[model samples]
Target chain A: MNALPAHVDIREVGPRDGFQNEPETISTAAKIDLINRLARTGLRRIEVASFVRPDVIPQLSDGVEVLQGIDVPDDVSLMVLVPNSKGLDNALRIRETFSEVAIFVSASETHNKRNVNRTIAESMADNEIIAKRIVAEDLRCAAVIATSYGCPFEGTVPLRHTLDIAEQFAAAGAVEIGFGDTTGMANPAYVGEFFTAALERLPGVEVTAHFHNTRGQGLANAYAALQVGCTSFESSFGELGGCPVPAGSTGNIASEDLISMFHEMGVATGVDLDAVIDAARAAQTVLGRKLTSHSIIAGPIDWSPTADAPSCR
Target chain B: MNALPAHVDIREVGPRDGFQNEPETISTAAKIDLINRLARTGLRRIEVASFVRPDVIPQLSDGVEVLQGIDVPDDVSLMVLVPNSKGLDNALRIRETFSEVAIFVSASETHNKRNVNRTIAESMADNEIIAKRIVAEDLRCAAVIATSYGCPFEGTVPLRHTLDIAEQFAAAGAVEIGFGDTTGMANPAYVGEFFTAALERLPGVEVTAHFHNTRGQGLANAYAALQVGCTSFESSFGELGGCPVPAGSTGNIASEDLISMFHEMGVATGVDLDAVIDAARAAQTVLGRKLTSHSIIAGPIDWSPTADAPSCR
Candidate 1:
């Protein structure tokens, strides 16, 4: 295996990606509270909310309130998801609330059309404009490519197609490009191959990996990306953020789980595992349901001196 | 990353390992049925039962009945767990019923004593006797070293100590040695290091990996094992078989989840993914609760022609 990076950047996306998929609407107060909790956990970036229309996603209708209410450390870069030019305009109205804005387009035509009711070309055209505007505003612009691995509607998306879209975003002045395994369809072998080519194709871009535990390969895929020296990642606490269209699909790889693995492997993430787990617990209480995070059930490895003599299993 | 093996052998240990930890007592018929189902799933080796005292583990007291009742294909090898000479004697009475017998000892002294009320030396001495008996009878002898990665009572078991135990077992006419992560304290980096040394030291024995999802690192550890050219693995269906001593620890890496990953990575396990999922589903019905296998929740990747146009996430 390739040598792993000593440290990696983790962006917490639970408030936006996680809450938007929940059936019940999370109050704006709770959203801000969770975001604040995450920001203190040594997480450098937090996607606090999305600028999607309230009617389209009622659960996140209070996005504006959440973005305005959260107070985080100066080092934490707050991010908001902007789907189109109109959404960017709404986010720009409260320009100081967040330091980064993300624009997304699916790699597959079918997924792109269904997700935003626009063809891949149309979405790319709009995102180019959006990316330019975000850069003009002097805020960091991140481009997310959904279904960069495989598409639920279109299986086995070609690597060339995904990289082409990433190249376009990189040329359009995006500082970072996140390849999302939107439905947990990625394998470690493919992840290794994809990121190897992606890093080579897009120089100087912060290539990030975003994975889901929908089929339980999330951490393994993350490990593969780490092997290939991809340093940035995005995850949701409490394993939230399932694809709403896939009935049985689960959530993004839990942030606490990712941190636990990285810490165990001696790769620093600058995140406190116990603090993130606390945030996950808070999420469980807010959602009033048992979340799918394994770390939440089994707390971080007890490293206390007294814990060394635990009874045998 | 190291090139993964083209094919790997998986030993299903759910019956003995999983059922013994269950709160409910499964009927002999149900155990036999599940064993038969697994046998047909292209799993060549299945640990069908254990010969522990009925009073100690009532769930598997009907080990003899289960071994006798199971009907499997000719290529399937039935295995039984034997704790000591006494257990092996009981299993030898129905020698024709099983093709392999496993003897286990924890690497850590405290864990060895706490688990079976015997010191490591005592357990090893008894297993030496059991190994000879099984070999004399021309049956396959497999040795398992519990707490091989990290002990719950004793943190960070030295790789040398665990490998020393494996060497003794290999010298004792044992054909296989399985290193177990009893409490899920293993990290992928450590796993890669452990297996690299193990495979180098034990040249002829089939070195197997047994991991728990207690901290949600099960599959990641398995992937690391694969990357190190370790091909033999033991897993439970429906993520069964957790350490009962750890209050909140979860179960083994789900068999279906492992197979799904291997299949997706273009590595073959010879197990039918759908068939194993069916068995996991049956286990859920038998247990009367939702199990934690993600493949059971999302099903396998839909590869049919019509699935190509799935609605976007």
Candidate 2:
């Protein structure tokens, strides 16, 4: 139980995942500063920025500028999200600057259609082609399977359908297979069921539990994944990332809050808790509004809530 | 493991626990109507009002009139809170009207002084005398140990001290026991561990967990208690108790939220879920402020939240 699978790798997704959701465009230096501050916090791996079309996610348009500006460490495994061949082409142009490039495929046909205008099977085929190209270019490929827990359109994803997609990614030579609870509806009971099933069915592939705090059950669900032996987690720093389905709401859980809970529970997350909170607080300033990360406002669980942290109305 | 405690007797403390905190003197007809409305909703046990001096708890000064006005059903157990010998004499006068009377003692000595101006020993002595008097009069006595989780003045009450006080009540012949998380510091971890310890220490004594959602963990803590097999929970219809320690703050977990979670988890609480929510909505007109219960304003969790309950500003 102590040797739990992989030891909770909080693959920091705030810079990329969080910034992509903000309607307001942040400055290039601010994006680079967010990553540099995150790197100093001892996060071994982070999704630095996405190479998506400039017109689509206007916030992350300065992706190359951010990467070139930040003095990121060599030991840090930097990755960026590639949506399609065009995004991958942009990544390859700056391939020398990063360690790995990740590709995402939706488990649900409805989501895959809305996400990247492809069916589930079409996305899988595209991901296979992209995975091979990345591998051939001497880069590691990690497959991010979105909506593994459930889909916003369809109530619950069939466990077998999600597992089948994971199997395809593992068989196609993915270094890691991450499960995304895209809608933030994954309960602790379901997390235990999903991961326990994955561990038994897909033993070779590493599992990452990425969750959202939409219903405030994100931390509980993460702990459930931990109990059943998952070591890697994906979260945004400031609990950022808007849900594509639920208009005007969040997607992933906050890295600062996740790390704080792990630290308080005596679990190793290999993240500097205070530095991460400070990073998220920096994010709050850039976002121009208070975000939902509990650690930033409540401080750590160990720190008794002083009358500080301007109470939210 | 799933055989959740059936019939989680929700001793409605709204009349007594609710009104005691308000400064204004509510009419006796309002109290009678409130109790009668709750009685129609299948609540078997209701803490109708408290018997104490006007100077001590001025809001409950018309406790005698309230008891006489309300139509008491034969099967439903009506309870009244008594402070000391004088309160006991007042309660004794209404002994013919009600079937049960609950006497509360503090687990923390410091809280006992601040709450009732007595030490644990003195409170126990008074409780023991009241406990015997209730039995002699052929009325059920439920000795509630307040601040069972943690005290405001004194921080955590050790499990041993809590069990010792519970043992005293059991020995003094209390038919049922209630535990109050008076300061709302009780988290799920504490509730589970304490309830498990209490069950092992005092084998057959019925235990009820009373918690406050001051930190948004009250309902979560109650669910944790159910996991460890303690079912009988006492929640105010709408969060209606006032903490003497923290003036102008929340006191108890919303009863409707507790019912919602229990029903959602498929736990048989034998409480009419919809009726409880309706009762909470009804209280808005009678009590004249927005309720603290989430399910009250937001509707039952299954009912997709079209509107969010206002934040306590």
Candidate 3:
């Protein structure tokens, strides 16, 4: 593998991705604090909120309110999920505030049907309309294809299917593509080999890996992706959003865990590890529960002696 | 990496590796039943029991009785631990019964003292005596070097220390050199790179990877070793074994979990996934507690609705 990039981008998705799966309603002020806390942790990109209707995802209904209320940083880029042009327009209305806009299309035909109640073809067609609004607002468009590896409903998603989704997104003016292992079926070997193949199929495509620790291979798969030279990755603080697959499994690789792994490997991520841990600990308080993060429970790599230091929880 | 080996050896240490951590005096009947069940799983090599003193590791003290009583198949080679000549004499008394004898050594000076109450120099000296006795008894000798990855106290072990242990084992005519990640600090990348380097340094060495999932990287580390052409691995059923490094930490990467990963990847481990899951579920019943196994809780790959009807767990 070639030498790694100058720096890795850690997109914190705690507020959006973390809370979305919870069966509780987090108040507006609490989410604003979460976003602010994440910003203070030296994270350059944080997926702030999703523009889905409140009826669909009650947890993130205050998307517009959250967008307008949170204190925005100048250098840190804020991205929110927009389901369609309507969500994109709402995202566009707040476009002057945030830095980037992200739109997603499910790669698996079965997942597309279950997720957005549309066919795989419909999701791609919807992205074109969403991309138009994003480009008009002078915002970077990131097209995320969920279930790019294997789907909960559909066992194995062909590489061609994922690449074609990328091709369609690129055609629709998306500047970047993020692959999501919605189910934790993607192994490191498969991810490494596939990413290498995908690079060949679509040159100059900036790919981001959004992996869930459903089966505990998220970080390993991330490393495999890194080995194939894809650096950008998305993680949730405290590993909040769990596997939406039928199992209610663990979610995206915990942000604290991922950052610790990267920093341990001597790679530059520019994220303040201590600050990230603090934010995740506070998130635990907000949720009124302990998260599935090892770093949070075990403390930092240098943690010792007082390993039994008073419990933060 | 080239194609995986057509056939890989799986040494069932559940009798030894799986039982030692369990907090119960598993009836000699239950231990024998565990062995009887495993021998039927078609595993050729099995570490039947350890010859440690009864007062120290009380669980396996009935080692000789368990070995002498099990209705073992001839093809299923039996092995036991020999901590010293006393342990070796226990093996030699049953030499007509058991086929091979395994001995323990530590790569780190401190770990050796902690594990076997022997200094580094002292363990090597014991190895020469143990190696010569086993060879004379017409028994195969497997030298397990504990804490080759990182020490709980000393931290990251020097590569030279581990190689030195391997060299001594080779000189002692050890039939196999089983590297133990006793501290659970092994990463797949580290395992891949370490074994690659180890193979070059100690050609014709038979290596077995014994990893603890203290940090949840055990299976990943095992896979990396397999990719690097090291096939034999040791895992505890129900993911037992407390990591000496991280206090109260549950490592060992549950045997069923490892088998599940390989089975799903179409890697022919010659293991029955259903039987293994049944075995793990049985282990849970024996322990009288819910064990942490992703494969057990999440079921198996075929647990998906899209797949065939759920097989018996």
Candidate 4:
């Protein structure tokens, strides 16, 4: 019942986060093609690839090639993920090519250690230095606090811990911050309160909400954040990047699904729903499997007055 | 954010709506088993079967047998769908078994013609007589106004038209009315506004929201209804009853998915989460296929502090 936002910013993470979790390796050219198609869909921001260790995540091994091969429009911002200083070094090598680079650390100590083999303090120290370097280099940077909503190992993360980390990231010269529901444990009530607290704690900062559809609350949580005045969001095309541990869990919220919801609610996202579905279809073909996206599966609600009646399934 | 309702009434319609949509017909015993499991899951109201023409919905041809087979508890109310006078006659044979009977008509004339070979006016005329009969028989009656949100054939149903239909149903001695998103076209904004108007116009009527997950807005729309103080909802276990007219379209909001969302937000449904999931699993086994409910697949989000971290899918 809150007044909805007039518009929202959608950041496509399919090319990077979506492809990285696939069991099969994606070619640089295929990744470039997907990203290029996505860019044309009126998505102004797309995370192209991650600069993680190739041995660790071979799916996104060709990060540099993907960034260089894709022909992004001037208006679209190409983002690359940087894990630590080494990843930052790789990103900085082609600093001018990417519009921004993101560094991530888990809110839970266990998840951070399991994900990156580093303690929270150690990751923070690395991020502080890397974030400062990226700011100094004049490139846009964001500190992504993963598992900001709830952690698999740690459960309900202390609100203080997440906010404290955001403050540190802001202090380290990070212009933007991202709170991730890395495991898809966020609820709408929690999301509304969390983002409200986040925005109040760090004013004048571009905060992004990244949610997964693992538990099917991704879009619901996104709406809650939007109600609380968090305008930017991160999602994947075709609902890619499904979590492996929870065998049947889905990945990020589909870009088309989120856009469709916003567009239906009279909230502008400046993204083409049909075009995003095209990209999602393209991704599905590349993967040789079906992806989990409701909008893509069920096309936009036909508003034509004389259309054929729907059948009873 | 709006304050969610403190409690919600969940009407489990899987035994009727869900199974009727499946291409394969389930055995009468299997239907009884699934219904029995659901009845024990703390679902106070369960739509056990539909008394439609056997030729039309052959999967639910065992309606009478299923009604006679299941052992419902004292606290549970067993509901059955009756299509016409004949269906009601069949239900009246064992009126003592069913606590309530629901008669349905589509908001769109085209859908009504296709679904039951009658115009909205003809159906309404029939419903008025049938509703009075059911009330006289000491059974609660509900007029299910299908496609109350948007008609697949007509599209964008006027709010005035829907409320007018609700007014008619309430005037016909129908104690309860259900507004169905037959093709999953209802948006949260429209839903909130629609329900607000429905309650105001039809004061003291037990209004229920019935949604399909065709475009994945079922739960989201349910949440919107909740925000507007509509606490009663109808969902199917394992998200059964998928729409066949729309290719690749999903079914109703999974009972577990809606319950999971409400439970997470500190709302009470009185139904056991794990028990509902168990019934969903049992339904999946009976159907011999995977279901669309996220809770059935992902299990509940583990809040244990020392639980194993989720894997990357």
Q: Provide C-alpha RMSD values for all models, in order.
A: 1.4, 6.1, 3.9, 1.5
Docking class of 4: medium
C-alpha lDDT of residue B191 in model 3: 78
Chain B only, TM-score of each candidate = 0.97, 0.92, 0.92, 0.97
- Specify the CAPRI tier of model 2: incorrect
**DockQ result, candidate 3:** 0.22
Please give the ranking of all candidate structures by DockQ, highest first, separated by commas: 4, 1, 3, 2
Write down the TM-score for model 1: 0.98
**Per-residue accuracy of model 2 over B9-46 as CA lDDT, tens digit each:** 67788888877876677788988887887887777888
Alpha carbon lDDT at B10, candidate 2? 73
Q: Which stretches of candidate 1 lie over 4 Å from their true place?
A: A303-313, B305-312
lDDT of 4 by residue, B191-247 (tens): 889888987888899999998877666777887788788989999999988464477
Who is ahead in TM-score, 2 or 4?
4
Ranking by TM-score: 1, 4, 3, 2
Tens digits of per-residue lDDT, candidate 4, A1-313, equal 5688899899998888889888899878888888889999999998888888888888888888877788978999988888888998888888878978898888888888888888999999989999889889988888899889888888889878999999999999887899988888888888888999999999989999998876667777887788789999998889888454478778688888888888888999999899999999999999999888988888777778774655552
DockQ of each: 0.57, 0.13, 0.22, 0.63
Per-candidate Cα lDDT values, in order, are: 0.88, 0.74, 0.75, 0.85
Model 2, span A101-190: residue lDDT tens: 888888767767767888888888888888888888889788888878766555557889998998888787787888887765566656
lDDT for each residue of candidate 3 in B5-112, tens digit (9 for 90 to 100): 545566767778768767677889888877777777766787878888888889888887898789977788888888888888877877777887888777767667
Q: What are the clashing pairs of model 2?
A: A8-A231
- Which docking class does model 1 fall in? medium
In candidate 2 chain A, what residue range of length 10 has the lowest lDDT sum?
A: A304-313
